[model samples]
Target: MHSLPESKKNHLWRKLVWHTDTDLHPLGPFHLAEVYCCDESNGYAIWYVRRLAKDDARGVAGVENADYLLQYFSKNHRDAAIERAVMLANADPSADKVIAALDRLAGGAQKVSADR
Candidate 1:
């Protein structure tokens, strides 16, 4: 959880803290899905990615501007949620497959948009 380097840690933390800041980026270990630590607006709001669909891309925010499934306030509690997200992404084979399918759907969207 806390094993990330200071630089990456700072960036990850800020991605949650500074939500509106365009410069702050999301950390993506899995394709099309991302994990945000916390944000300044909401205290330690962590999100988890479950299964994603092509249209699940709605309400996208953050630097990656992707979708997330669960978001809750943690009242200064940190790292645990991020750790959970990482663990969930790694441990859940079904979620991984869903992400892959979503990725392909997203790719098709890009191609359609390009053709337009």
Candidate 2:
């Protein structure tokens, strides 16, 4: 739909810089990037991306690049991706009481994943 403002994009870029360089063990960092981008907006925005992605791939038969989320996450992980995404999103400052909530979730996720 609408292009995000440069300022907003810049902010997101800065926030993501730390994560972009992480080693791709489970998956590459770009998938995480896509998930972060998709989560930046509300539910309606995610729906719009999905709808457009579907439309964009209507003509393609076998190539799996049609689904926006799938395409976005192709470079990284698929399983538990949404869960990780939700955890990352909670780190957004706009979420009230986000610091405590995000810390808990992030810490918990790290612990869980560490044992894997």
Candidate 3:
């Protein structure tokens, strides 16, 4: 809903950077967020709740999957990508802990991703 300051966007914004090689390199099974590739076919964020021991191509296909938490797309644009991430975190039962981590990202990033 709001824009983050340049400094904060650089530091707090946990983005998945683009890579030319392995699509999986930037996002293994453990990453919280990866760069939203503008060029990629799958326009969504991969949220992993657990560490992926191996690259399970089958993916977290079921609701019973405890490792793969969610996959989503944010049509609002760039910063919105992280926004969707926050929403997912907040929805989690461990919202307090997850929110704390996101808050820390803001601190380390020197900015918060709006109060929402």
Output the number of the lDDT-best candidate: 1
Which order, best to worst by lDDT? 1, 3, 2
Ranked by TM-score from best down, the candidates are 1, 3, 2
Pick the winner on TM-score between candidates 2 and 3: 3
- Pull out the clashing pairs in model 2: none
| Index of the highest-TM-score prediction | 1
Weakest lDDT window of 10 consecutive positions for candidate 1: 107-116
Model 1's alpha-carbon lDDT is: 0.39
* lDDT agreement with native, every candidate: 0.39, 0.30, 0.36
Q: Estimated TM-score per prediction?
A: 0.35, 0.21, 0.27
lDDT of 1 by residue, 9-111 (tens): 4324322111222344345222235444544345444343222233344323211233443444464656665665455345435544534443443432321
Model 1 error, position 64 (Å):
16
Model 1: number of clashes? 4
Task: Assess candidate 3 and give its TM-score to the true structure.
Answer: 0.27
User: In model 1, which runs have C-alpha deviations exceeding 4 angstroms?
Assistant: 1-31, 48-66, 93-95, 98-116
